[model samples]
Target: MIAAMLKVMVLGVCRDRGALAMAFVLPPLIFVVFAAIFSGTSGTEMRLKVAVVDEVRSDETTRLMDAIANEPSLRMHALANQSQQSLREAVAYGNADVGLIIAGALTQDGEQSPIVIVADAGRSMAGPILSGHVQRLIASQLPGVALRRLIPSVDMLSGGLTSQQRAQLISSTDEMNTADNSKSITVGESGAGLFRMEVLDGRGNVTVSYYAGAVAVMFLLFSAMQGAASLIEERSSGIMDRLAVGAAGTDVVVASKFLFLTLQGLLQVGLIFVIAWIVYDVALLPHLMPWLATTVFASAAAAGLALFMASACTSRQQANTISSFLVLVASAVGGSMVPRFMMPPWLQDIGWLTPNAWAIEAYQGALWRGENTWALLTFLWPLALVAVVSLLCAFALSRYRLRLG
Candidate 1:
């Protein structure tokens, strides 16, 4: 009996093309996507976009900027004619991951540090990562500058250095700088005091807000897909035919399902965020209006996508397998499972196509970043359009199925 049942199960799965693909093909594909995304996150291969403002424009700062531009880990853009404010705006609006301002001479003594790193609060890691790169460059490419800065501290601590000692130190630094550029020399000291960090839109733990939005959209997609699976059951049981022939019609059936799924998704998002507020203190109430708008559009998009998937699938098993594959893949690529910044440039560009990306961005902007109405709309409109197009497609597919039946 065990052998017979095993054969029966295997035959059933083999006969279903969707199930076969889901069982055999989905795992490797998902593994590949995840590998490509996560393998570069260890700082060696991660490429960060850096916007630079050279206010001093001195020879030392110019050398520093050129070294940064040549770095493999950083994609540096020089804002030659732009101000530090422009660089800040670039980081704020996502034009660059982080901003650098060389406000003074590298070796100059002043009340403020010569370097400034501007970063967004949500992507808090970017600031530190860029800081590390800058420090590394200063130590390796600009050893003279590093040595000059160190001399002041040394003089302060030791009372003074003789002219001969200072001259010898300066000669060593110059020789190190003029040495083979390929080999990097380690400086025991850190460049922490050489730069100040300016974090933008920091409000009540932006990391918590990011995860709240990410989890909300991901579970919303899953819940909406599960709820929409009822269409497959109804069709299989002849209820779809009865409803199609009645005064209500199949259109009403699909529309009603879409509405219910949308409402279900909205409730799911609300509950998740309420917990986030209670436990994580994610600043939900302050931006309630835009939050609500983003929630509604996100829910509608999930519902429409779910309906379209359900309408196209012929069986519950197929729908389940396919929906799971798609939702997981989309969530991974969409910055829900991991921050998109951690992914390589190509994968990050692909994330923009997923609804999870837009929903997360909109929610983060509305709640954490305190973005204006216009900025919020840029993220919201894509979700609204997805809802409209998917709903129309699902409706047409359902009507076609009704005619065939």
Candidate 2:
């Protein structure tokens, strides 16, 4: 009897192809995505987008900029004829992960450092990584600059080098600069001190603002999916058939569901942000208008996606399983689970396909970065497009494909 029951279970499991795929296929696929996202976090394989401005334009600055531009791990955008303000804007607007401004001579003058690293507080990790690369480049590519800067302090401390010592020191410095010392020299923390970091939009709680948007979009997708699953239940129970023939036909049912789910998502996101505001001081009240606009579009997109998933699936279980897989994958790639900058270049590019990325960016722009109306539109339109396209697709699948009435 036990063996017969076991056989029945095995056969039943094998017959359900969706369950089988969900149990076996999805784990490995999710592992691959997680591995791809986390594999480069150890700094060796990580790549950063750097926006550079050379204000000094001297030989040293040119050499340093050239070295940085050639670095394999960094994508450098040299903003020629641009100011430090432009670089700051680039970083603030997510055009670059970090900004580099060669504002003074490479050799330190008094207490001021020459290199400036401008970063958005939301992406705080990028600033230090860029600084490390700059320090390494200065030590390797222009060892003479390091040696020249050190010599002045040494001379002042040692009561000045004698004429003969000075001559020999000059010759040795030139030799050190000309020789291949890439493998021999290492820049320490003191060398890294040559960089000054200027972080933007750090007054508010940056982490809360960023992850609030992330969690909001993710849960919006999930809640919307759960609510939309009722369509499948209604279809199976003959409720949809009954509604199809009534004065309020299938169109009304679908439209009403869409409206309810959208509003539900909006309220859900509002509750999350309201808590964020009360607890973390996330500047919600200050940016209420743009924030509301972003929330509405994001909710509509979630509703549309959920409806489409429901309309396409034949069973509630299948819809749940598939929606879970898709939502998890989308959240992982779309800067919800992790910042998009942390992912590789390919994954970062793919993130644009997910509504989470657009919604998160729109919210961040509205709350954290204080982006202007025109700039916020760039992130808004994609979300609106997703909502429209998905809603249309859901309508078509329900009306024509399913033939409900």
Q: Count the backbone clashes (under 3 Å) in each candidate.
A: 0, 0
Write one digit per residue (lDDT tens) for candidate 1, span 1-405. 999999999998899798789888998998998888778676466788899998898877888988999998899755545798888877876668899998888877776888989999877689999998998998888877777778878877999999998888878877766565666655554572688888987567788889989988999899999999999898889999998878988889889998998888888999988988889888888888889999999999999999999999888888999899889989988999888877787878899999999999899888877775567999999999999899999899988887887
lDDT of 2 at 205: 87
Report, for every candidate in turn, its global Cα lDDT versus the true structure: 0.86, 0.85
How many angstroms is residue 151 displaced in model 2 relative to the true structure, after the best TM-score fit? Answer: 2.3
Model 2 local distance difference test score: 0.85
Model 2 alpha-carbon drift over 4 Å, by segment = 78-81, 156-159, 163-171, 180-182
Sequence-dependent TM-score of model 2: 0.94
Clashing pairs in 1: none
How many residue pairs in model 2 have overlapping backbones? 0
On a 0 to 100 scale, what is the lDDT of residue 279 in model 2? 98
